[model samples]
Target: MFSDILCVILFCTLHFIASSSELQPGMPNVCADQEMSMLGARQPCVQAFTRMVKVWKQGCNSHRWCMGYERRTAYYTVYRQVYNMDTHTVYKCCPGWRQDGKEMGCLHRVCSANTCFNGGQCAETGDKICQCPLGFKGTQCQYDVNECERDEGGCEGFCCNTIGSFYCKCPEGSRLGPDGRVCHDVNECEELNGGCQQTCVDTPGSHHCECNEGFRMHSDGRTCIAVNSCSVLNGGCEHKCVDTGNNNYKCECRKNYQLKRDGRHCEYTRVHCSCRPGFTLAADGKNCEGIEMEIVNSCEKINGGCSHHCEHTTNGPLCSCNHGYQLALDRKTYSDECVSGGACCRHFCRNYPGGYECSCRAGHRLNPDGCGCDDVDECLAETSGCEHDCVNTLGTYECFCELGFRLDQDQHSCIYLLFRKVPQLLQYTAALHSRYVSDEDDSDGGDREVEIQRGRRGELRLSSSIVCLDGSFGDDCSVSCEDCDHGVCSENRDQCECAAGWTGIICNKTCSQGTYGPACNSLCRCQNGGSCDPVTGKCVCPPGVQGLLCEDGCPRGHFGMHCRRKCNCPNNGHCHRLYGGCLCSPGLYGRLCHLCEYQ
Candidate 1:
């Protein structure tokens, strides 16, 4: 009986160990640190599952405990369930899945119930699609679309299509066919063992070109250079050419200088020169000087002899005869005295200092002084140039024009109308003395027609008696008294006078208070005393008088004129009165003997 108890105990113990080998209550299969799976506890359940290990019980209640026989039986049954759980679906206590002694299910089992579009398996996902093992797209199962068909060339140069990928077209310097669709550069320089003979240059398209010492450029394009110093090489010649840039050169000189047609020699100025008029040679290679005109002894000769007027000609002298005056029959000199009718005009005549003038008749005037003739205005009968409506001025007329008319070039008579309408010629008008005539055309016969004498322009002839009191001459007689440097011609007597301290018509006004005569041409003697005349200005004193105003003569013992003499007195003695000898008073001695006795 003991042996039987021993065998039963051993069996019970073995069953407990077996069940424990799998996931018993509160136990883990693989380490609790293992990654989770949809197969749940068949693999293992971690701590978050409170029933990580399943405990055997008499009934399927959380609080129920197993009986002695029931615990043993339950242990044995749970041990078998744990051992076959992964491959077997039939179970007793664990209704669904059994992992060791604990029962659970595959988390993916419920997901297999749904379908997806296009045969895609419908699997639970977070927010995005979760594909099944060999499925794609829809809930139940899927499509096997080729990804590469969607990507056309994918990029530029050449298309590179990979399994599910595509890459851009790449030419020579690139590499490809990697996990990502991209191309990387392959340095040909490194492959060719360090590139160019002279220098390595990188470029697009292709590389490997060459440049000489003075030039440099990229491999992919053409490159060239030149010496660039041709001008310096030819000694900067006038004109010539060599080669420079890209193979070209030139030689030339500065502007303004010419280059020989030969294209090498240079030249400055192009002109060949001579001299200018009146010029002489200069020391400098190019300049000259002017020569003066010469004057000679022979005078310019003229055709006529002396008459009323004479003018010097280039070769000699020419003579012009006035109206009334003429050259003698010999034609040597001018003469005014003539017979009843000479070369001169009629009634008016006179001989001048050098020539002669002709006087016109009572009702006329000589046009240009002694030149010709014109009528005088007598109508107004002497009331200041005329008295009433003037008749025609004769030969020396008052420039009288008839009613509504004026004199033409021949001032002798009058015309019924104006010679010309322009006023420009009016500038020649002078004094413009005028009068009225009868305007027969208009109703007014004698009171309306005006006549005028347009005398020489800028000239004024005052009455002979009206002279400039301040000593002025000429037409306006405008001369200043105080600064008149030419002295003056007295208005009262036409006398010549010098302003106060000066002399000469223009006064030549200067200071000469102590001098007198023509122009202070004489000295004064105020040292003695004597004033000068206010006009002719001479001193009024006797021959022997001398003083500031000539008030006194020489004192008692002095004589000779101007008090410039003295008596011959000895030793400073007193002289006798009125031509007497020295008095020699007291003990004084000498000629005038006025010395004191030796005391």
Candidate 2:
């Protein structure tokens, strides 16, 4: 019953939503419930997701894992016909961008975020181009230009510098000139009484407010209040108060060095500290003092730097090959063992990850030693679901029906096909069977089986021609293609699709000289003058490109190992894709292109 429900894509394959097809309607829903796919979802399993940087306990970079923090699961009421089964597809954050958690969108990249300062906007081209607003300059528009720095800002009064522009200010008794730079004298008493509560006094360039003898001027300088002693509000002190002249006082801490929060409270200055990546603190409570070296398991860091499997041991992560394959000396790669020695077995071999397993022909069983092929007597074992006689062969078995019946498509059960049987016809068919049947062509001349043809009147007739089963071909279908020893039989059933490094008529020969791939027909695709494995065509890129294919250039603003390092070049400088080096801009000589030539 659980099969009817589409898997939520529990922990992976969220990219399936991006690539689904219409599932054919009323096709009997032939897919098994297990086939519903956490591996392939019909739609977006996650409604929203976020990207995270520095994910803990994480160490792989492939298109197989969804690089996101999923916030919630999304359900669809309508069923979809399409499903994406490509195991390699997954949503991932582009270089220089990470998810907030593992949610829906790494939608934010370098330019997508607010990287610019002081009203600067980054270009969407992903080259880290920062477009600065007026009165600001620098790579990220971080520098505020001060307009008043030169020629006194061409103002008669004082000039005030602001973010984008500057303004002029006149003296207290003067009004700003129409030009906004000149100043004109004016009487302060004429306007708002100079902001005085009681009396106003006008000066040459400013004004003053006065209060009665019983009252004192407030901090605002425009209002007055009654004078009070330290008894009022405890002089707003949190520690010992020292009375000064005119009821004024200062607060002092006892054990601590300073006062906090408006000089009213006292506390010790707390130090919040932390250590770097590989170091821990000492037992003596020193600041990051203990320095110890630890060789972490490479597998834990990056799967032991192996392309296949990595096993952690007492010493370190040891790379190992998958079954049917052998590890190389470097321990990071593996080679197919079947082509080397596995093909010696009489039975065929099936391919799988890491290794291949030897499999016997349709009705044959492999001997204990694995090289010998023995026929399985389905008649003796009673395992064949045949409704009639079961005939055993050298490496397979065949099912036969009673005189009036015919073989079913299953090839095991008998179906009533003949409308009537004649005694003379039966005798003639019996004679023919006795003359031609002995085994899979072991009788006299490869004529072991007879062909059944349907006539225009819907009656079955025995023909002299012979047709082979699915895997068998040749004259009577009795001749199984024994040539494809450890490889797959080709579509035409004439040749074999040899493994990466193997070739030849029977796939018994290795790839010749510098050739690789199926039948040794393709060449390696290594770039930057790199080398490659002749058998697998696996490229070994030089110190430039970061892709396994040795493609030039890296993701935007990223370079170096795993393309994980970000470039800090300024003024549209190019960055090395594999080394994280910045190619400085013209006239800019320093590492980050910050130093000017004249300087």
Candidate 3:
């Protein structure tokens, strides 16, 4: 019996130990911190379920008991469930945003065409202007326009701009590229060899640098450094070594020196040389020449060694100097004239090698001697193209017209006035002395037509009486009147009684396109931006444009310039283009015409 009892005890102890080992939750099954995104786009993914341990009566611990009766404490395992929240804390980027490299936060994506400044606005979208006016973008308006993409913002070189303002930028040592969608060549060589130390070779698409003949490329590539020195190889030459092509060399002698028979060495060869009669050898013991020689038209050879021009003549090497220069003592070189006070031009003088030239300023002419400038008389020279009279001033000229005529758009010709009517008494002149015409108000209060002041320079004003019904003076109005050249002939043949918008020999022609007045002398005086009748000079104003020249906008209740067009708009609705219907702003729906768009 004792042995059996001991066996039972041992079995119970082993079973109990095994049960405890099985219940050991080592790492809680590795419940990793997990998360899920919420419905809100801007909301961050956050802890979904609580990260606390699950301990709701996970069954009482059978392995051990506290005081045999205390409510058995439950065993539990810890885990984490994440829910999306608090956008600032999220590790992932939201829609429309991306992680640029290892940047701490997501960066706004943009195109790489040009510099992207700070601006994005919905064109006509109401209210909901922008979440962040300067930086952030929310979807209220869709269409966008950046200046860089349009005409390159008028910059002949590369250009960039945001909706607000712009700042031009280029990498150092670079030039602004042409504007628009044009493919052009940027002369890299133009900007100081494009940052190259030596020769800069440019191609249609690229450029590069090259070293000189006896130079080797440096580590920096663009710069060039000389070779170790010809002493390295001696070149097997006695005097100097010259490199021609790859692996090729040649020997040369110094001035007044000659090479030996072996071609490897050089020796002095200076000695007296035989020359023609009247000639002597130079100090170098080489060349021989004479002080004077005779030759005809000898300019072809080396341009006669003249600094500027060589005159071909029977004489030998007839050398001459250019305009602003003078022949030097040697006659082969030239010297500046203005440096020694050769300038005598009245206005300004420019000097060169052999001579100097004088010129006049604008509105002035050079005198006959070519050394002085004088004010030109425009009237005497048929200049200014004046139809009536030319008045000469200090350095300019003015054009004036007769009393009945006005200056034409050409500023030189004179034409009849607009809407002229004959009065009971007339005061006028054939010729006046002043230089310019002054405009003064006429008798009518609303009239823009002007009348000139009385004669001041002892000019006469002829007062005429109405003898004949027509402007003609000879017997039966047979001859056409000079004053009625392009005006209508009234029943009595009165020139001033002619109707408006007539032209031609007898004022019978109608004014041509967009022109006004019988002689088409006056352009329409319509203020604002109104279009005028070519013949009658009547103004036609556009909708919402008011005043004589369409100067102001239409009022709320009406549309046309005269407030003729009326509309029925309610709930703070506004008129459409022609005011034919109503248009609402943001909130109101349809007041008659639902023309407003949401975004």
Candidate 4:
């Protein structure tokens, strides 16, 4: 039944109202009730509806005609007699004029009521009563019987009452039952009188400890102890033992006395000489003097009182290294010169505290800027090596193979080494140089014609120099057309044409998209400009545009579709080109200013 109703509503809204082509002068009503007709005498129906309205309007005036009742269920009937001509026409026209084609349909909803529990309903028989579930009982179901009450065999300990519930508390030293009922003894003596130190006395709900006489209450007020100790002055000093109460104390010697090894005797003795570690026995046996006693100061050593490497001023040993010598690992002086193998690289060599260091070879820099050697990239023009790739290995440079050739290990120059003909020894080197040289080739134009042509399978050459030396043909007398510089390569002369976002002989530097200027430096500068090709960094201009580099912004009120037409919105809607329309601004409607109504 519910499905059928929904289908009817859907059909009315979707087909009848949506499609103007589906309208007809008269059609049979699709309502479930048969009594109601599409066209009926409207007078009697209106009268009945008016009376129904009066009964439902609780606080509304009857004359106002304002609808207050929920039109949940609809009743339709064809009047046999014509009650009023005006009403008849109204009834006939009403169905056709419905905005959604679903007029006069009815629905039913749950009714409102006062009886609720915890914000929920007390339905059916108990209309206005709060219906609480089990374990709950009260006038308003707001309170529960305190099972924990003192009388109802309740909480044997303490009682706590809450809304719709109550809890039990065990006696002072007992625990409440699992069911929250009776209280059980804790047996304070079991856990050592709750950690107490004496006999435990269990009371109704609590317990107390009985400590022996001499013991005072501890912080916990439970433990006991012995009566006397060394803590008490003269309390237990049998042989002059310092009175230490609570079983702890120390024995001290009387005044003018020294404690013996056993901590019992006190005796007075004269001076004795047991010299310290750093000092030695003096010949007199009454005084101690330091060993190795030299009689010179630092100033005296400065004035050359000592020999070659001695500091005789302060009477201490000297501190100096022999000529061309430095301290060895043993801190002993030795004259030594570092040979080529041990000499430091370009950096200066100084006599260090011990040993020596060798600087690295030339064309090399230090690691961490100054600590270790890192071969310099001689290829960098600034560093002044070869004009090309500048690969810096341990100590030397091997001229790299140009774009096409591979470098010869023995000759120190580039050589024509093919993957199929030459050994794999040069493969790694060829790959590196290719990557490095290709980046610079674009700026060096001359080779543009070689890109377009097809060559023998895998027979592509890297440079025209290779071709010149090998005597190959393909016009322009250049080398392999495989990798050309100018944009894309022209098959003829090793030539290439640059693409967008790329420049120089070969497509090297990447140009930013949505930007176009010299060297692709300046952006389009046009606000709301469409993004050009990402690679070439060009701007797609709309029609009727006039400006150098397309940098001028769009004119006011005229936008979209080549900036051809003026914007059209009711009042002032934000014009959106993508949608080909304007979004009416707040308090506006219709295209451009066509409609003048507030939102």
- The numbered model that scores best in lDDT is 2
Off by over 4 Å in 1: 1-21, 24-29, 33-169, 173-220, 223-238, 242-256, 259-268, 271-599
Local distance difference test values of all predictions, in order:
0.42, 0.56, 0.52, 0.43
Could you give candidate 2's per-residue lDDT for residues 160-184 as a string of tens digits? Answer: 9997889999866687988999898
Query: Model 2 misses residue 584 by how many Å?
Result: 48
15: Cα error in model 2, Å: 99
Residues forming the 10-long window of minimal summed lDDT in candidate 4: 450-459
Q: List candidate 4 stretches off by more than 4 Å.
A: 1-114, 119-130, 135-153, 198-203, 210-214, 230-238, 242-250, 254-257, 260-599
Lowest lDDT block of 10, candidate 3 = 449-458
Tell me how far the alpha carbon of residue 537 in candidate 4 is from the true structure, in angstroms, after superposition: 64
Query: 1 or 2, which is superior by lDDT?
Result: 2
Give the candidates in order of lDDT, highest first.
2, 3, 4, 1
Lowest-lDDT window of 10 residues in candidate 1? 450-459
In order of TM-score, best first, we have 4, 2, 1, 3
Cα RMSD of all models vs. native, in order, equals 51.0, 57.7, 39.2, 41.2
